[model samples]
Target chain A: DAGITQSPRHKVTETGTPVTLRCHQTENHRYMYWYRQDPGHGLRLIHYSYGVKDTDKGEVSDGYSVSRSKTEDFLLTLESATSSQTSVYFCAIRPQVYSGNTIYFGEGSWLTVV
Target chain B: DQQVKQNSPSLSVQEGRISILNCDYTNSMFDYFLWYKKYPAEGPTFLISISSIKDKNEDGRFTVFLNKSAKHLSLHIVPSQPGDSAVYFCAASSPGAGSYQLTFGKGTKLSVIP
Candidate 1:
């Protein structure tokens, strides 16, 4: 609840279609992260940004792209959605870039690709 | 290749009893760990965290124990209530350089039965 908001809280798209999820934060935290939560998969990091325009791929970065042109916004896009990509997406933020920093998350976006 | 692992997929505890969730990590380099809780349709919320420098940290009914030697961490929730039903994830991170990203476990779904 750290002033985070994820647009399109629910989205349903067909396979082969492009889908984008937006995460916005007012906390002005320097570290932002995009994660996907699937059954039996917990929460896997997909992409993260240390700063504006400074993004890095996570363990499950494949088939996904991220952009952070502004410090308050991070975007995750799937060029070609697949049924396997259906999952609840979460965006998290940390005030610092250290492991000890406390992280906050948005409400999340539920995406279903049929 | 999974640095953090939650071996238990689910757990059931009677209300007012204690609940324990376990997590393991394969990386000794991970200097810090965190526990997060999530209910369906909502994003994960930070529960408790402990650093490698400490063995235990407690907050209210939640306590986190970190055993660096075996690379294991556990979260204990006392007086579990029906509202405590949710999926809990154990996440780890190594401090240094430019990384605030956390590697999360698959998670354990805990149900507090009345």
Candidate 2:
């Protein structure tokens, strides 16, 4: 898993609730990303951080916000969870070296919203 | 509007036969491409990668071929094994985009029958 951990590996929540998923890495890599995987959608980047406190929106960034207050942690928060947001979330880290820009992925956090 | 696309939803191949997965992209600036394999309940894992500057990259039984002019790429696994059955995703990234964030396809599920 490339020394990456995603907290709350499985969670069931209600619609209109708030949820936050945490990603921690021991690699101390400068780049970290949050992605969601759903049927028919392999993986869509929700947000990414290039450095501490530097985050940017991705293709499916709507309703999702991310924060990186420290070098080892990147957090993704769903301000208001929706039924459509129920999916498997993955955290990834990229090594500084450009070994074909390879990125490593965590196990994944499955969230179900009712 | 997906920048990357994997047309096949699923593929079935005989054990010890050849397996080929295809992907296409619409972005002209994409300079890097990669293939990832995912099993049930696990995040996608990096399998192989290729740069736009090169046409082919080989690693063990996996070979990735890139055609920059057609904006397409494929992964060929010769003598495929049943253990290779999984969902395969094709991802792309542009170096000039400043961030190494990747765009991924819908993925193709591969089933290797014994």
Candidate 3:
């Protein structure tokens, strides 16, 4: 509840342009994730970071990349925007512990590739 | 294949009644299950969760039931109010104590009529 924030609440961009979405966490959690929500797909993970300078691909990592320079911030970048990538992007934080590991999501950023 | 599935796309219930939302999963390895509520323009908020070790977990007016044998779980909201109306998502993850990632259902839209 006290931990996550996403930038650019809403954005409209043309195709072929690059876009970057940012996620910031104050809890200093070790794990951060990026996900996209579509009409049929509830939420699909794009990429996640386990620690500073450590990141991994997820189920839907195509055309998306992520970086974590610091423990509190993660950035998801789209090299070339397309209509297919247009959706509500969400940033989440999950602790390393599995038993009590709960993931909290950001408010979400709506990106439209027109 | 999709491990998590929500058969119902939407449900409507009268205010002050029991609202039950169902979810099914194909994965047997999932031990941690969570339910989330999402309103318009907001991220999904954690509502309740039940572990595979337990058949049921309750908090306030919300209760979650997990049936390991059937690979099914349901969320019951007693005395539902208009404020309870929102899209409900069911998420599941493996029980291992490591970097955990969640798979979510398509979500069920619950409309509580006043």
Candidate 4:
């Protein structure tokens, strides 16, 4: 409903393979973030971008990487995916800057590594 | 250490009753708190939020109460319906750090029985 879309909504990949997930938004929001959800972990941030080409690592950025080339597109890359990395990934955007606006999340992408 | 925590893993409430969910935070810097609801196969949606300056904020049947002294927050849903059953997550952010730095709790599943 927020005009956010995540590609490859469901995918099963083998271990040691490379995978990338794309997030596209039509709202033109400046801040975009990638988060992973696990059973015991609510949501852990992997990476975030404040503006095009500006990215920062989050608390759980060990094996993941992200890139933002345009205002509407943010990409997350998992190089040599591991079984431990299997989880549901979500992309979110903050509606405004310097305000207490709520962040909207896109339908999650489920990834499985075997 | 986990900054945000939701002690209860699940809660059950009868229809038309009240459902209360609790969250706690360890960081004193957190000034903004948010509650999100997630149904199966979809992303978590923003439900309500409150700032540290206020003790309570209400929106329709949903109310969020903040106890700054105790570093705790709770969400109440009156006249709970079956549609209200879902996983609820509590998130906290420091206003100074902005919204992208939100820390989320593990979440509590709510079941509204008819």
CAPRI accuracy category, model 3 = medium
What does candidate 1's lDDT look like per residue over B75-106, in tens digits? 99998999999999998888762456788899
Classified by CAPRI criteria, candidate 4 counts as medium
Give per-residue lDDT, candidate 3, residue B67.
Answer: 88
Top candidate by lDDT: 2
Over the stretch A12-75, how does candidate 3's per-residue lDDT look in tens digits?
9999999999999887889889989898899889998889999999889999989999999999
Q: Residues A81-101, candidate 1: write the lDDT tens digits.
A: 999999999998886535365
DockQ, each predicted model: 0.76, 0.85, 0.78, 0.73
lDDT per residue as tens, model 2, A10-114: 999999999999999987899999999999888998999999999999889999999999999999999999999999999999987666678889999999999
Flag regions of model 3 displaced more than 4 Å. A96-99, B96-98
Q: Which residue pairs of candidate 4 clash? A: none
Highest-scoring model, DockQ: 2
DockQ of predicted model 1: 0.76
TM-score for each prediction?
0.95, 0.97, 0.96, 0.97
Q: Which stretches of candidate 4 lie over 4 Å from their true place?
A: A97-101
Q: What is the C-alpha lDDT profile of model 4 across B1-114, one tens digit per residue?
A: 999999999999999999999999999999889999999999999999999999999999999999999999999999899999999999998856643578999999999999
lDDT of candidate 1 at residue A73, scale 0 to 100: 94
Q: Model 4 — TM-score against the truth? A: 0.97
